[model samples]
Target: MSLQIYDTKIGKKIPFTPLRDNHVRIYACGITAYDFCHLGHARSALVFDMIVSYLRHSGYKVTFVRNFTDIDDKIINRAQKQNTTCAELSQRFIDEFYIDMKALKITPPDYEPRATEHIPEIIDIIEKLMTKGIAYQADGDVYFEVEKFPQYGSLSGRNLDDLKAGARISINKIKKNPMDFALWKASKPGEPKWDSPWGEGRPGWHIECSAMSRKYLGDSFDIHGGGEDLVFPHHENELAQSEGASGKPFANHWIHHAFVTIRDEKMSKSLHNFLTIREVLKRHQPEALRMMVFATHYRHPLDFSESGLRDAQTSVNRLYNCMAACAALTDGTESSKAVATRAEIDKLRSLPDRFQEAMDNDFNTAQGLGCLFDAVKSINRISQALPAPPAQADINLLRRGGADVTKLAQIMGLLSQEPQAYLAGYQEKHLTAVGMDKAELNKLLEERIAARQNKEWGRADEIRDLLLAKNIELKDSQDGTAWYVAGDRGQ
Candidate 1:
């Protein structure tokens, strides 16, 4: 099936056809780079990352561009508070952003342009707007005249009258209309400054995206995306500036992911409820958080909570466990009866299509993950039923199924770690949570293995029961005895 994405501008799902055949250009608004990234940032990054991954997986040559607003008011304010330059502060946070993104296993964009690096491009766009009479300079500040652009609110679905009624423009007496947004702001004594036709000032938030996106993705791109919070004045004003200056549509598809909320309220610094990616990763595996993000539809609101994360962790652990079991069964000898039927092999091969189907329907990651979980269940079932010296054909089937599961999981950025490594990490986390010393538990397990080797069955059973009393369950396999927290069969 062809891809169909939900277009925020049209308020409906539309078939995704790139301007050029077999190639897609995407521009997603990146962070302001004033502080550490929060869960909201992580969601936005992962949503686009999945989109790009699926696009490439579907055979499209995708050029993804995500820009950073490194010279914003927030950066300046933060720099002042931290006793540093805006450049230094933004660079620090940008470095931290990369670290967090790497920890979450997010792929880097093809081009990560910084707003401060494109000063000339920003000035050029503002100059074009000025020449077209869509922008005016008042006391060294350049503002896009919202009344001049007929389609000013088209992208946001707000008419001029409605926008004016609810406008929250700065109280600068120099503006013509209350809704006129700044394309360039006059620099103060200590703020970042650039030489522009309008004067020494930096580009506004909206203009930076317009200028940078156009510079990389051209006058029009396949998709332009950001959070739902940007739908209002930010994107609305960006559309006005870019289209009004170029006399063309800015982007074919406008994709906006819904917000990440906490306790039914939007997660924000002002609410004092924002959770940073670093802090969350400190407590849970990065893939667990990614699972939590993907478990919901991209356009739906995701309420961040501890319970949600635990559930996601459990789900991820199940997939890893299934993978591990399949790996174990792959070593068994094959028998003719163990050779999967043609129909069975076909069904296993069709798993990728099922996963693609879910993803194609507007990047429905939740449904895609459901398909993956189904595969996990099937693989686990097959592994559990394997004979004691499994047939070579059945071993091949199990190996193929494991490979298929890993490949499909990669498309969604899950199950990247080695199965044994992931399981060991899960066990470690469980031990830490239960206040059990991992070294002590391992020493006891060693003692039990020694006792069993010496034919001391009673002593080995006593050691097992002692561990069981502490909520630990031990499973003995051909390799060795493994222990995990009780009731966590997935681990």
Candidate 2:
């Protein structure tokens, strides 16, 4: 089957053909790194991550480059508050970002170039724009000449004349047109500055991405993605800057993920309604978070709520149990379930094909996941038969089906963790947060251990019930006993 994706540029779904044979180059706008990442950031990353994953699964060699805007105004402002250099503050968040990404199971991009590390590349692009008369300098600042780029509003489908009338203009003396955006801003006192032909100033927010993307992915790339909020000024300006400088199309496909809202309102720090990734992960399993993202299409708004997460958690738990049950059913048991027959296994093998069909239709993750849930439901029923220790063929069917879910989940950077480990961490974090004394809990657990060792199942069950009353959970794996407290709390 041929791969197809919805191209925002064409406003339609089309067969996906790589610029090069069996190769794909994708550029996703990364975080500014001024503070902790939020759910919105996670969504954008995961959305493109899925694109990259599916492309690879379809046999394309993908070069994924996600840049870091480490030299933005926000980083400088944050540095001032911390009484540190912008480089120091940006690096701190960059380091923290990877930690959160790991916890969320989001894969790192193939290339993560930082803006500060690529000043020369940014300056070269700006110089090219200047020589081309697409950009001009004024009072040590350089701004893109919107008039030179006649197609400036085409990507966004907005008329500049209308935008100028309705939009509030910035009070910058250097701007020749109300719509012309800055390519570079002159340095301020005590702020980070880089030497450029134009003057000692840093790259503007949008230019860094254009320069970095071009520097890594070349003049034109397969796909460019970011939050839908960036579709207007940010990505629109990027198209102008990169294409204007290179005289080539910026990206063949433009992908944008919709905003993550809280109670129908946008999640923003200014609005005081955003939940940091660290805070949210502190409460829920990362896979559950990823599932929440997968529940909605990339182009649709997702509203965050406790009930939604609860539903996601329940769904994840059920999936985990199904996978576990499949793992447990060994070769031919006394109670061989009819659902694990040769005919049934063959039916299960067709799931990946169905999953690919859903993904081929514009990366429809919701539909793809529905296929996954259907497979998981079927497997749960089959595993009950406990077929004489399931044969390699049977296990292979389960593995293939489970791997499909795992692969899709990973593409979205969700549910890629060992199910037991995630459950353990989820329980431990919640228990520890609820003001439980570990030493006291351990003493009670030790008593239960002695009873279980003496084959006193009743006493062990009784002791376990007492801990359950305190909202503590115990899981008995082959290794030993582990306990955790439970609650919906934030870090």
Q: How many clashes does the backbone of model 2 have?
A: 11
lDDT of 1 by residue, 57-100 (tens): 99999999999999888888889999999999999999999999
Query: Candidate 1: TM-score?
Result: 0.93
What residue pairs are clashing in model 1? Answer: 333-390, 333-391, 333-392, 334-391, 334-392, 335-391
Worst 10 residues of 1 by lDDT: 330-339
Best by lDDT: 1
Q: Tens digits of per-residue lDDT for model 2 on 399-452?
A: 676776666556556556676666656666655665666687788788888888
CA deviation > 4 Å runs, candidate 2? 171-173, 333-346, 386-410, 413-468, 471-491
Tell me the deviation in Å of residue 471 in model 2.
4.6
